[model samples]
Target: MATSKPQVSPELSKHYSARMVAVFRYGSLAIAGIGFIQAVIFAALGSWVVVAMELSAFVGGLAIYFLIRRGHLAFGILAGQAALMAIAITMGLILDVPTADAPRISHLYLLVLAALGYLNYQRGKSRAQLVLIGLCLLAFIVLASAPLTSPFVVLPDMARTIGTWANAVMATTLLAVCIHAMQAEFNRKDKFSRDLMTALWNDEFQLAYQPQVDLSQNTIGAEALLRWNSPKRGAVSPVEFIPQAEELGLMVAIGGWVLEQGCRTLAEWSKNPLFRHLSLSINVSASQLMHRDFEAFVRDTLVKTRANPHRLILELTESVLVTDIDLVIAKLDGLRELGITIALDDFGTGYSSLSYLRRLPIQQVKIDRSFVQDAVNSSVSASLVKNVVLMSRDLGHTVLAEGVETIEQHALLARFGCIEFQGYFYGKPMALADFEQRIEARIKRLA
Candidate 1:
């Protein structure tokens, strides 16, 4: 499945950009070393100034390495490189340095300096770095054109000087091309991610209602679970994408859609008397609950869908209760006052499971699949399940064991007085039509 575009925070984006710049800085330094070697060989059998300049560039690169290793700002390293280039320009002006036949050599140095300055500008927050980059560019321009205008006999021939100018222009063009390409690729990936998310939001996803049964009544009470029916990838599980959606701040919208869809399904089911009494539960994530208007959202959805609030159960994980216990209690109490039932989902999975049960005004505890899966074989898991079910019962909360696939597991749970059960043994998650039919068949059998 095509992944949704991740919504990275500004601080995180800057951190990622800094890391990328660090890698690029090292790569550029290596390339600069190669260029310096060529410059040294070309100017050999001649001036000592070329050797000194090459040594200066090497030393400057070492300083940049230490700065990066020490966790200093990457832009600071680029700024230091610009300063070294300025020093080189000053030395060339004072010494009247000899330039080899390769005029491109001088232009290459100017281009590298300009690139470092521009990158520093990109990574900088304050205007100082930008201003520094502008100064560096201006200096490079003067240094590059000096051979053409001055009595400094660096490049004595006009052809050599013209070649130098051409090389500088070419290098500048290449840098621009690289910048443009990076920006284009970033934009393209960003747009693709946005489009993928939009599609997911626009009902490209499907909903599956898993039957949560009341073991006492042998009747199915459905819980609406989200299933993404991607056009390209078939079915995408909520376990995979919901966390990403929450991180991107898209969970509220997606949760709203699920609420509406679930209520609508309940209203439709209510038409059949046999299915009318089946309570439909929907899982609400912590992010959805954190919204200030969440209580109103739920109330409004019930009113709009004409579904009975009492029959609409909102399943919340224990993690939500622990994060902000007072807030959760306040919100849940308000929900209960509205006659909306709340179920504490995946009950024993959290850190402070027992403490949360006492604090939150919850009506039911859906024992997590982990304990239920192991209850048939493992004594430890069975003991844990028995304790949870007994505690919940003593506390006057309904306990439901999930993932009961075997008759033995079902019989074991029944022995422990777990009044509610749900899993593949009763029935796999089915479409709305199939579920209604199953409800009818089960009702007839009971009758």
Candidate 2:
């Protein structure tokens, strides 16, 4: 009973790049080790032809390792997995004969290759990756049932028996490693989902308002950005957690809380002369908008907080329109009935259909930061920004350019007829109290 130790190098790697490097580094070594061991066994069995095949695996694996270390990540992954599949199939057909006691187990490595192939595809979507995965799966199934008649010298009975046990041990060990890596990611997400629910209940989730300003550089409004300071994980970016929340079906609840808090803030602002006219834009996820009672929820929050509906802007991304355009429009119309303004956020980043834009009850268009940042250098981006401004304004949508980080970018956006803006150039997202104080100071200076 020989137990094989599994390689789990990616257990502690956090970022995707780090995980990728760790997997490739360890996976390549493991492959090479398998090849080396098989080559030694076949050499002892006097299977010279099989020894050459095994040595090829050893060399191929080592080549992939060097390629990966040299930063040829994509090529390394594709070549390594493909080579692994070829070797697995060749060896399974030639030597791994299924017996009553020793079943054909070499083909089992194909399943591991399939898993790795899927992971690679997930990292980067490509047709070649899909083909590799399909080949692995097909090879696995076909080889599991029948082995082709080998022209090359086959392994002896004793060698087949030893090889079966070795293959079973190694294949299962590698398979477990893949499963553990995948399960680790799932477990992290599960833990995050639970933590998110607790954070919602404990009021750990917060909204930081990034100021949106007019051309006059006066603070006119702000977008409420979600932030979380987990006691266990420290401060987690919305980039990392928002999509998770959406996937876990928790965004609706989180959105409701944000709406409530935003409305309350609006109500408080209404009492201040300077802040009375300032609008607050709160982002609405596709799921939140599609929620059957989203309109009623907003109405209830408005009624409860007595927030001025005119001062509340719900920012919807272009991606949301892909879900159900008619339903989205209906929801927007219903929300509009409450006097809450609708603003399309992250413009030019998704499917922006003229027909859908014409139908959506939107009052504003936000130029995504990518365009704004690149507008200064790239003519294509600049022209796109200019055209988006013209088109959005033509549709009577107030255009706001986001991610304006410099005075030069700000000047370019202003020149392009985008009057309203939101970005770090004006002010970064800050606490509500700080935002109000900043706004107050600006008002004093204007006076």
Candidate 3:
């Protein structure tokens, strides 16, 4: 709400305008329906003036609906309706009907106006502040004049009878509109979540391999990245759907799938002697790493796929490892004892990547692309990266500099003692087949 762009808010707030229109339309229908019911009650009691007022409310609500639908008078309609309600309550107070009824009606109207004002403020619609001020002033005037007015003012405040009904109708309308908006939002998210679930089952997610070339060792390795091709959503990013998968209790299953796919790719590559020594790395989420059967999953997948566990690498971000250092260390040790390697992905971006680097059983550290991409242009980034590369190499760990998109970055990192590199300078992530062809060609050229 503080930001100028309301459309950029939460999922529900992004649809605030549409929700407001719905509220107006639904509120209008509610007002008309309640007004008609009031009219019938007054007709039985022979109260013509009260009937007229109720009928007026119904017409006003109808007019507001049309105004909003036409994209005209949106601001005026919301402000005018609140103003009119306040005026009606003020009139009721002036007419000294009964201490019990007039004041209660006035207070009820004030509360309803406040509710509308708060919603308007959150929505940040046009003229909401002015409208709130006007409503507040109206309430003050009604309360202030309640004592000074003459004993008999007008038609004995017939609104007391009608006010109760109108208040109830408006309250119910507001409540229903909010509930409807929330339900609509959930339904929208549920659709995508369902698509993701179905996609997981239908084999819609695939892996892309980015080579992590260890220049000093003259060896090739790769990091496996997940890509989702949803039939409904079309190329949904991991940023958008992976968290949803995690929240839906599907990460363990999805993570297992990734592990198997990466190992299967490794198995295929093993046929080509040039690619046999390459480390095939796949990312592991915190949830997956902490999973009770994660180690077993890795062992079983490697056995079934006939993929060499010695050549398999499991990558975890710095923050993921810091969740519980002991658990991470134990897990990494167990996997390493099986001849599998553990990598610290996106290092230097986390608060304590360095602090825990020595503590964890990590074999390699990948300097985050953010540091490399900006290092050429930013002195601070370059300094941080230099320290990281130097410190990591000194620790006897395989240091990889990722996102080395230029000859200069690759040359600079190699000079900085970073033995490994991955980025556009070498090659982007590619399908297993494409990468195999590239490896074969590079090997042939060198021979």
Candidate 4:
């Protein structure tokens, strides 16, 4: 038995780009080190001032790279690195190239600076970067004028060329760098998607169970929530990747995994007499349920797990049933015949028609959290919850108020004839190990 329920992880963006930025900086640091070492080897040929500037850049780049690797000051470091590259290139423009070089060093450096800026432009410094790039381009024109455009920036005897060729080379280099950056981004995303495809059977996914309690504050059932923790991507929300899975034709496989895992949990929990009669509910996607073999799969899962069919519930959103009502109805009927409970989850937020209630074999309707959350403060919301409860009773279906977080909210819903309740108030979703202990403890207490 466990002592505490599983704590909810913090809400975070699944598609965070910080990892990629860190990886990019890791490469940049190596390049900066190489540049500094090259400068040292050729110190005798170039201006000492140029070597000194490269020294500072290399040292600063090293510091920034380590800071970003530690995940410290990420946004600031990304923006600063972009600005630093632009500045270093601009300043390096005034330096004498140690070896034979193109005469349009200033123009080339400016375009390179612009490309760096554009690559890191969307890293939270949009407008400032635009100004920086614009200034760099404008400086090219400013430097072309009389005093700024001296033929010999250094020695009087040094020959120079500022023809159509220099401009074309600069333009071509900038375009190629931009194209390369875009292609790199595309490749990064492609690799992430492919990794997720391979991750399905790699034990990267799992389920969390949130208890559903009745009016007496005793646990009777739970909703099994799907969660994934990717090795490369960190924690991923079903909200973020489930749609992607549907598009990639991975949902059927993922959904099957959920069903099997949920059944396995039930089989394990069946050891405790308290959990023997408890219902386990799992969400099914429209496509998952629409599959011809879905019923057979469910039946086989229950038989294999030795879980009673009466204690298994399959939840589907009301909107899912609207498009192919006839086909869905036929499929759902077969599920009900197996003594599996069917529920309408997130009930009121969708197009909830009495027609669905009358025609479908739904055993319960979960009142969407919106109305339950507002029921305490809003009279209209309270009335709506009451109406839903009464309607469900009239139609021989039970009502479960979801997201009931406060005593006042719970009291109001309990008065409205809601038979079962679920939310943060009763218990958060917990791991199977912790939830099993919770069930044992609660049953003992009630006894």
Candidate 5:
């Protein structure tokens, strides 16, 4: 039997950006090495002033590296970009003379900084970073057009030639490394996205039924969870792929498949006395609800499968509400008119106002697991859960506290007047065959 504590999987965004940490760490070290090598070359050429400037660059890179290691990643990136721009501008204007053999190549480094700045800004959306990137571009254009009068610490012909080649190679190599890492990350994601498409075509995904119970511990229903067991990647968590699916515009198609399978299961259960009364909840994404033919699709599925509409519950997250409210309400109401129940899933974790509870055609409110798990220990969580139950009841919406992984949590929720429950505490999600066997076992025990 699977354990009661369901493992929490990180969301896809977190997983997707995890590679950036490694990239930055190694990239910082590489930058520091480049600075130190340049300093050494200058020292060998007896250019004391240039050697000092190069050593400062080395120190600056190390400072950024240490800052990142200390968990100040944003600050580290900002500092690194700022320092690189300063060095490039200073060198292009003063130290790096435009010789006949080696024109001012220091300005080219600004282009690299600009690229890095853009990448950082995309991730953080910082206005300051955007401004810095603009400055880098401006500096690059200005420095490339004409060399400034000041040529302090002019390098010897030998040093300028050697430095030009060294600077070009190092800067180009740095840019190449970053691009390569980014390209590899993109390729991996692209491959995964392709795999997802192929998975749908090959039927690599299956549904797992997790039992939902009443406060009395009696099984009432199950939530149909989508599971993907990739042949190459083994068991992939929905948390790691669902967002990608949505971004790829594949969620509507995937959700349709889930609905079809769920309706078919309802049809199968209608013939079994033991499971006929059970309600099956399926999560609906924003894309699915907003689809033009969603209402017709659900209506047709119900008619084709001959499944009881009352036995189907559509769980929707708060994100879905951030759309055309009237349109959403109309679609939900249409589903409700057909005897399908609409549930607000992951309640209290979104930007939805209390006014939505009164306005939307929500038949049930599924309390998010974060609040439920902390309810027993956190006064704030307990109070929130209590109020949600009261408010849901007052609004004529059934309350289900999901992620009730312990007896204490279940008891606390019951005391708070929550009637319905779903979580690992009751039973982990299992295959359809296993779910049927579990239901039969429970029925026999009760008899």
Candidate 6:
């Protein structure tokens, strides 16, 4: 792979990072603030020791926040908080912070702190951070329970009875709060992810076609391309987002949608006898091919749009062939049986390029743009294209040279026995309606 310079603006990247930090800091502060308020209320109700413990926790949290802000905090912040919690519990026991009337509140505070520590640990992105947080939470839980598990049971006194009831209430409240917090976080993250996808779907992602003309007739034969649009970002280039969508598991849906749209457009165009000979080609992502229901989806879309399967060409990248040679060949064969022509896109871009020619059920080879762009200036590139074209011809596959941006380049390709060409020299991509008008005008002029 070619190593390219970073494409994102440095300022934008920095701003994004800063925003994430702010969210993390504010989220932590909010949790601490709630704990502090609860402690104050409990203290006012005559549970001074519990209030003191809560205050200590609040102070510890603030210290952690500062350390994080300064970029000096280690993963040990969780451990440190757990230690402070332990110390608070010990002091409470020594002075009897929870009276006979409210032993339950003290237990609730300890349990809630432990739960918070556990959540902090689980939220850490790295394994090291997670382990540190887990240990801290564990320590807090152990320390908080040490006194309560003492061998000597307090006599069945009023103070003991009140403490037991308070502890029960505190446990119930803590459990409820933790459950609500977790549910809210899950819902928030889910909504954010869904919104991001929706925005991407509506954005300026679009398909551009390279006309595949027949060498014998010198007329436009077909248009092969895919569409992608993003709302926030304008025109996310396929070369940039295709791989990302595959990695992020969004390609199947996107690719299927593109297929349906392309087929429907082709069916609409086919109504004109002038365009009857012009085929439509759509690129399929590896993720889409790997889906168990892909073939069925393609069949259903073709039926729904009433598009001729023979006129719909499906293009697959060489990367897909490389994934599992036998599987790809089998899948291509299935598509071929449905009368859908298969083209190997970006033919020479991957490893084992020559191997795919013999193994896959490909009917056409679209020479990658890189070779076409360099063919005019470099003999090596020219020779590579010549060999690929010759090889495809020998295998009874049609060859289409992509990115033919100059007349000289077009002339050179023609000299090398290359037939079909598509690039900016003819015309950049236009809207479907504009393209149709151009086609009509060209036909009229020729007539």
Highest TM-score scorer: 2
Query: Could you tell me the C-alpha RMSD of candidate 1 in Å?
Result: 12.3
Off by over 4 Å in 5: 1-25, 28-169
Model 6 misplacement above 4 A: 1-196, 200-206, 215-219, 222-224, 227-229
Task: Please write out the lDDT profile of model 5 over residues 1-447, one tens digit for every residue.
Answer: 011224443221233355776777677787788889988988888988888778877887898788767767777878888997898888788888687677888777788777776656645567888988999999998988875656456678988888888888888987887787767767878998999999999999899999999867888999999998999889887866786787799998899899999999999999999889889999999899999999999999999989899999999989987899999999999999999999998899896778999999999999989899999999999999999999999999999998988999999999999999998889889998899899899889989
Predictions in order: lDDT: 0.67, 0.81, 0.69, 0.68, 0.84, 0.63
The estimated TM-scores of all candidates read: 0.58, 0.78, 0.62, 0.61, 0.77, 0.56
For model 2, name the residue pairs that clash. none
Query: Relative to the unseen true structure, what is the C-alpha lDDT of residue 409 in candidate 1, on a scale of 0 to 100?
Result: 88
Kindly list the per-residue Cα lDDT of model 4 for residues 124-220, writing each as its tens digit: 3457668777876666555444232222334212322332244346446555755676577667657856866877969898788888888788888
Error of 5 at 5 (Å): 13
Worst 10 residues of 1 by lDDT: 1-10
Range of the 10 consecutive residues with the lowest summed lDDT in candidate 5: 1-10
lDDT of 1 by residue, 96-210 (tens): 3335544423434555555555655444354665665666667667765666333444533653564356545645654665465457546744553574587655778666666
What's the CA RMSD for each of the models? 12.3, 7.5, 11.9, 11.0, 5.2, 12.9
User: For model 4, how many clashes?
Assistant: 0
Q: Which 10 successive residues of model 4 have the least lDDT summed?
A: 1-10
Overall local distance difference test of candidate 4? 0.68
Please state the error at residue 270 of candidate 6 in Å: 1.5
Give a tens-digit lDDT track for model 6, residues 157-210. Answer: 444465456545654665566556666655744554464467556644455554
Better of 2 and 5 by TM-score: 2
Q: Write the per-residue lDDT of candidate 3 for residues 1-447, one digit (tens) a residue.
A: 000111121223323445565665666666667657766776676767657766766676677666655555345446546754754564455532345554444344344445454555544444655566476656646664555443543443554556555655665556565556656646756886798889889999988877778764344788788888877778766655676777688889998888888888889878877788888878888888888999988889988999988898888876675577787788889999999988888787675555687788888888888889888888898888899987877777888887788877877777777878888778777787887788788878789
